[model samples]
Target: MNITYNQFLISDDKSLLQLDAICGFLGRSYWADRWSRETIAKSIENSLCYGIYDGGKQIGFARVVTDYATMYWLCDVYVDETYRGTGIGKKLIESITSSDELGGLSGILGTKDAHGLYEQYGFVRIPDRFMRKFPG
Candidate 1:
Protein backbone atom coordinates (compact mmCIF):
# COMPACT_ATOMS: atom_id res chain seq x y z
CA MET A 1 0.00 0.00 0.00
CA ASN A 2 1.04 3.56 -0.68
CA ILE A 3 -0.19 6.52 1.34
CA THR A 4 0.53 10.22 1.41
CA TYR A 5 0.51 12.49 4.42
CA ASN A 6 1.39 16.02 3.47
CA GLN A 7 4.71 15.75 1.60
CA PHE A 8 5.56 12.34 3.04
CA LEU A 9 4.78 9.00 1.45
CA ILE A 10 4.57 5.64 3.20
CA SER A 11 4.97 2.51 1.13
CA ASP A 12 5.40 -1.24 1.55
CA ASP A 13 7.62 -1.49 -1.48
CA LYS A 14 10.78 -3.27 -0.30
CA SER A 15 12.72 -1.98 -3.28
CA LEU A 16 12.18 1.60 -2.13
CA LEU A 17 13.98 1.03 1.18
CA GLN A 18 17.35 2.60 1.86
CA LEU A 19 19.57 0.02 3.54
CA ASP A 20 22.13 2.43 4.93
CA ALA A 21 19.45 4.76 6.24
CA ILE A 22 17.57 1.92 7.90
CA CYS A 23 20.64 0.34 9.47
CA GLY A 24 21.93 3.70 10.67
CA PHE A 25 18.71 4.37 12.50
CA LEU A 26 18.12 0.90 13.88
CA GLY A 27 21.75 0.40 14.90
CA ARG A 28 21.40 3.41 17.17
CA SER A 29 18.10 2.26 18.61
CA TYR A 30 18.08 0.87 22.15
CA TRP A 31 16.42 -2.34 21.04
CA ALA A 32 18.60 -3.12 18.06
CA ASP A 33 21.75 -1.27 19.10
CA ARG A 34 23.84 -4.37 18.59
CA TRP A 35 22.35 -5.36 15.25
CA SER A 36 24.70 -5.61 12.31
CA ARG A 37 23.85 -4.28 8.89
CA GLU A 38 23.79 -7.84 7.59
CA THR A 39 21.31 -8.83 10.30
CA ILE A 40 19.10 -5.86 9.50
CA ALA A 41 19.13 -6.72 5.84
CA LYS A 42 18.33 -10.34 6.57
CA SER A 43 15.44 -9.33 8.81
CA ILE A 44 14.00 -7.06 6.15
CA GLU A 45 14.38 -9.75 3.58
CA ASN A 46 12.26 -12.09 5.69
CA SER A 47 9.58 -9.74 6.95
CA LEU A 48 7.04 -7.31 5.54
CA CYS A 49 8.61 -3.85 5.60
CA TYR A 50 7.09 -0.39 5.51
CA GLY A 51 9.08 2.63 4.49
CA ILE A 52 8.15 6.23 5.15
CA TYR A 53 9.74 8.78 2.90
CA ASP A 54 9.95 12.50 2.31
CA GLY A 55 10.39 13.17 -1.39
CA GLY A 56 12.94 10.39 -2.01
CA LYS A 57 14.58 10.28 1.40
CA GLN A 58 13.60 7.67 3.94
CA ILE A 59 12.29 9.19 7.18
CA GLY A 60 10.73 6.26 8.97
CA PHE A 61 10.43 2.47 8.87
CA ALA A 62 8.63 -0.51 10.38
CA ARG A 63 8.40 -4.24 9.82
CA VAL A 64 6.11 -7.07 10.71
CA VAL A 65 6.92 -10.78 11.17
CA THR A 66 3.78 -12.62 10.29
CA ASP A 67 2.14 -15.57 8.65
CA TYR A 68 -0.40 -13.24 7.00
CA ALA A 69 -3.07 -15.35 8.61
CA THR A 70 -2.98 -15.92 12.34
CA MET A 71 -0.40 -13.72 14.02
CA TYR A 72 1.99 -10.83 13.58
CA TRP A 73 4.73 -9.27 15.64
CA LEU A 74 5.37 -5.61 14.93
CA CYS A 75 9.00 -4.63 15.34
CA ASP A 76 11.76 -2.28 14.24
CA VAL A 77 9.35 0.63 14.33
CA TYR A 78 11.12 3.95 14.14
CA VAL A 79 10.83 7.46 12.79
CA ASP A 80 13.83 9.69 12.26
CA GLU A 81 14.37 12.01 15.21
CA THR A 82 13.57 14.99 13.03
CA TYR A 83 10.24 13.45 12.09
CA ARG A 84 9.05 12.63 15.58
CA GLY A 85 6.07 14.55 17.07
CA THR A 86 4.58 15.07 13.59
CA GLY A 87 2.32 11.98 13.89
CA ILE A 88 4.29 9.99 11.33
CA GLY A 89 4.78 7.16 13.79
CA LYS A 90 1.09 6.95 14.39
CA LYS A 91 0.42 6.98 10.68
CA LEU A 92 2.94 4.19 10.13
CA ILE A 93 1.31 2.04 12.77
CA GLU A 94 -2.12 2.90 11.47
CA SER A 95 -1.16 1.92 7.97
CA ILE A 96 0.39 -1.33 9.13
CA THR A 97 -2.43 -2.36 11.40
CA SER A 98 -5.11 -1.49 8.91
CA SER A 99 -3.53 -3.10 5.89
CA ASP A 100 -5.60 -5.83 4.24
CA GLU A 101 -2.59 -8.12 4.41
CA LEU A 102 -2.99 -8.29 8.17
CA GLY A 103 -6.76 -8.09 8.39
CA GLY A 104 -8.21 -10.15 11.27
CA LEU A 105 -4.78 -11.27 12.46
CA SER A 106 -3.59 -10.79 16.03
CA GLY A 107 -0.88 -8.16 16.50
CA ILE A 108 1.79 -7.97 19.18
CA LEU A 109 4.78 -5.79 19.93
CA GLY A 110 7.21 -5.22 22.76
CA THR A 111 8.43 -1.81 23.79
CA LYS A 112 10.15 -0.47 26.85
CA ASP A 113 8.46 2.87 26.17
CA ALA A 114 5.63 4.02 23.88
CA HIS A 115 2.96 1.92 25.54
CA GLY A 116 0.66 4.91 25.58
CA LEU A 117 1.11 5.41 21.87
CA TYR A 118 0.31 1.79 21.02
CA GLU A 119 -2.60 1.76 23.45
CA GLN A 120 -4.24 4.50 21.45
CA TYR A 121 -4.48 1.97 18.65
CA GLY A 122 -6.10 -0.83 20.72
CA PHE A 123 -2.91 -2.57 21.93
CA VAL A 124 -2.98 -3.65 25.54
CA ARG A 125 -0.41 -5.23 27.79
CA ILE A 126 -1.46 -8.83 28.25
CA PRO A 127 -0.26 -9.01 31.83
CA ASP A 128 2.00 -12.05 32.21
CA ARG A 129 0.58 -13.81 29.22
CA PHE A 130 3.64 -13.42 27.01
CA MET A 131 7.19 -14.69 27.27
CA ARG A 132 10.43 -14.43 25.37
CA LYS A 133 13.55 -16.55 24.89
CA PHE A 134 16.49 -14.72 23.49
CA PRO A 135 19.38 -16.49 21.81
CA GLY A 136 22.27 -17.39 24.01
Candidate 2:
Protein backbone atom coordinates (compact mmCIF):
# COMPACT_ATOMS: atom_id res chain seq x y z
CA MET A 1 0.00 0.00 0.00
CA ASN A 2 1.09 3.57 -0.62
CA ILE A 3 0.20 6.88 1.03
CA THR A 4 1.16 10.38 0.00
CA TYR A 5 1.48 12.95 2.73
CA ASN A 6 2.50 16.29 1.29
CA GLN A 7 5.57 15.52 -0.82
CA PHE A 8 6.58 12.28 0.92
CA LEU A 9 5.70 8.78 -0.13
CA ILE A 10 4.97 6.14 2.48
CA SER A 11 4.72 2.58 1.24
CA ASP A 12 4.92 -1.02 2.48
CA ASP A 13 6.83 -2.22 -0.55
CA LYS A 14 9.95 -3.84 0.83
CA SER A 15 11.52 -3.92 -2.62
CA LEU A 16 11.72 -0.13 -2.53
CA LEU A 17 13.75 -0.07 0.68
CA GLN A 18 17.37 1.01 0.48
CA LEU A 19 19.59 -1.21 2.58
CA ASP A 20 22.30 1.41 2.97
CA ALA A 21 19.81 4.06 4.07
CA ILE A 22 18.09 1.67 6.45
CA CYS A 23 21.43 0.65 7.92
CA GLY A 24 22.40 4.26 8.24
CA PHE A 25 19.23 5.09 10.21
CA LEU A 26 19.35 2.10 12.53
CA GLY A 27 23.13 2.27 12.76
CA ARG A 28 22.83 5.61 14.50
CA SER A 29 19.88 4.64 16.68
CA TYR A 30 20.63 3.88 20.32
CA TRP A 31 18.60 0.68 20.14
CA ALA A 32 20.26 -0.92 17.14
CA ASP A 33 23.57 0.84 16.72
CA ARG A 34 25.50 -2.33 17.43
CA TRP A 35 23.57 -4.56 15.04
CA SER A 36 25.32 -5.84 11.93
CA ARG A 37 24.00 -5.12 8.44
CA GLU A 38 23.40 -8.83 7.87
CA THR A 39 21.43 -9.03 11.11
CA ILE A 40 19.36 -6.02 10.07
CA ALA A 41 18.75 -7.56 6.68
CA LYS A 42 17.63 -10.79 8.26
CA SER A 43 15.27 -8.97 10.57
CA ILE A 44 13.75 -7.02 7.71
CA GLU A 45 13.27 -10.19 5.73
CA ASN A 46 11.17 -11.66 8.52
CA SER A 47 9.11 -8.59 9.35
CA LEU A 48 6.61 -6.35 7.55
CA CYS A 49 8.48 -3.16 6.60
CA TYR A 50 7.37 0.33 5.64
CA GLY A 51 9.49 2.89 3.90
CA ILE A 52 9.07 6.67 3.51
CA TYR A 53 10.54 8.27 0.45
CA ASP A 54 11.22 11.75 -0.85
CA GLY A 55 10.73 11.62 -4.59
CA GLY A 56 12.83 8.45 -4.75
CA LYS A 57 15.33 8.59 -1.88
CA GLN A 58 14.29 6.73 1.25
CA ILE A 59 14.21 8.96 4.33
CA GLY A 60 12.21 7.06 6.89
CA PHE A 61 11.26 3.49 7.79
CA ALA A 62 9.42 1.25 10.22
CA ARG A 63 8.80 -2.48 10.54
CA VAL A 64 6.23 -4.65 12.23
CA VAL A 65 6.59 -8.18 13.58
CA THR A 66 3.14 -9.69 13.74
CA ASP A 67 1.11 -12.89 13.80
CA TYR A 68 -1.81 -11.32 11.87
CA ALA A 69 -4.24 -12.50 14.53
CA THR A 70 -2.90 -12.00 18.04
CA MET A 71 -0.46 -9.08 18.20
CA TYR A 72 2.33 -7.08 16.62
CA TRP A 73 5.56 -5.48 17.73
CA LEU A 74 6.36 -2.21 16.05
CA CYS A 75 10.06 -1.38 15.93
CA ASP A 76 12.96 0.32 14.22
CA VAL A 77 10.87 3.45 13.57
CA TYR A 78 13.06 6.19 12.18
CA VAL A 79 13.08 9.35 10.10
CA ASP A 80 16.15 11.07 8.78
CA GLU A 81 17.60 13.63 11.19
CA THR A 82 17.62 16.14 8.40
CA TYR A 83 13.89 15.70 7.97
CA ARG A 84 12.95 15.72 11.63
CA GLY A 85 10.12 18.01 12.84
CA THR A 86 8.49 17.88 9.43
CA GLY A 87 5.74 15.38 10.41
CA ILE A 88 7.32 12.54 8.42
CA GLY A 89 7.59 10.35 11.47
CA LYS A 90 3.98 11.01 12.37
CA LYS A 91 2.88 10.20 8.85
CA LEU A 92 4.98 7.06 8.92
CA ILE A 93 3.31 5.90 12.12
CA GLU A 94 -0.08 6.95 10.83
CA SER A 95 0.42 4.84 7.76
CA ILE A 96 1.51 1.84 9.79
CA THR A 97 -1.14 1.98 12.49
CA SER A 98 -3.98 2.75 10.09
CA SER A 99 -3.13 0.12 7.51
CA ASP A 100 -5.96 -2.36 6.97
CA GLU A 101 -3.76 -5.36 7.70
CA LEU A 102 -2.43 -4.00 10.99
CA GLY A 103 -5.15 -1.63 12.27
CA GLY A 104 -7.29 -4.03 14.23
CA LEU A 105 -4.52 -5.97 15.96
CA SER A 106 -2.84 -5.19 19.25
CA GLY A 107 0.30 -3.17 18.58
CA ILE A 108 3.13 -2.36 20.96
CA LEU A 109 6.28 -0.34 20.58
CA GLY A 110 9.18 0.67 22.84
CA THR A 111 10.60 4.14 22.88
CA LYS A 112 13.21 5.78 25.03
CA ASP A 113 11.70 9.16 24.27
CA ALA A 114 9.00 10.43 21.92
CA HIS A 115 6.28 8.92 24.03
CA GLY A 116 3.94 11.72 23.11
CA LEU A 117 4.14 10.82 19.45
CA TYR A 118 3.22 7.20 20.03
CA GLU A 119 0.65 8.14 22.62
CA GLN A 120 -1.31 9.97 20.00
CA TYR A 121 -1.93 6.67 18.28
CA GLY A 122 -3.36 4.96 21.41
CA PHE A 123 -0.08 3.39 22.61
CA VAL A 124 -0.17 3.55 26.35
CA ARG A 125 2.92 2.98 28.44
CA ILE A 126 3.07 -0.29 30.34
CA PRO A 127 6.14 0.28 32.44
CA ASP A 128 5.72 -2.92 34.43
CA ARG A 129 5.63 -5.36 31.49
CA PHE A 130 7.59 -3.54 28.80
CA MET A 131 10.73 -4.99 27.18
CA ARG A 132 14.26 -6.39 27.30
CA LYS A 133 17.04 -6.93 24.75
CA PHE A 134 19.08 -9.99 25.65
CA PRO A 135 22.32 -10.62 23.84
CA GLY A 136 22.59 -13.47 21.36
Please provide TM-scores, in order, for all candidate models, with all chains considered together: 0.97, 0.96
Clashing pairs in 1: none
Residues 1-136, candidate 2, lDDT per residue (tens digit)? Answer: 9999999999999999999999999999999999999999999999999999999999998989999997899999999999999998998888788889999999988889989999999899887885578977
Q: Relative to the unseen true structure, what is the Cα RMSD of model 2?
A: 1.0
lDDT string, candidate 1, 37-133, tens digits: 8999999999999999999999999999999889999999999999999998998898888889985799999999899999988799987998889
Model 2 misplaced stretches (Cα beyond 4 Å): 131-133
Q: State the displacement of the C-alpha of residue 13, model 2, in Å, after optimal TM-score superposition.
A: 0.4
Which RMSD values do the candidates have, in order? Answer: 0.8, 1.0
lDDT against the true structure, per candidate, is 0.93, 0.93
Q: Count the backbone clashes (under 3 Å) in each candidate.
A: 0, 0
Give the lowest summed-lDDT range of ten residues in model 2. Answer: 127-136
Residue 5 error, candidate 1, Å: 0.7
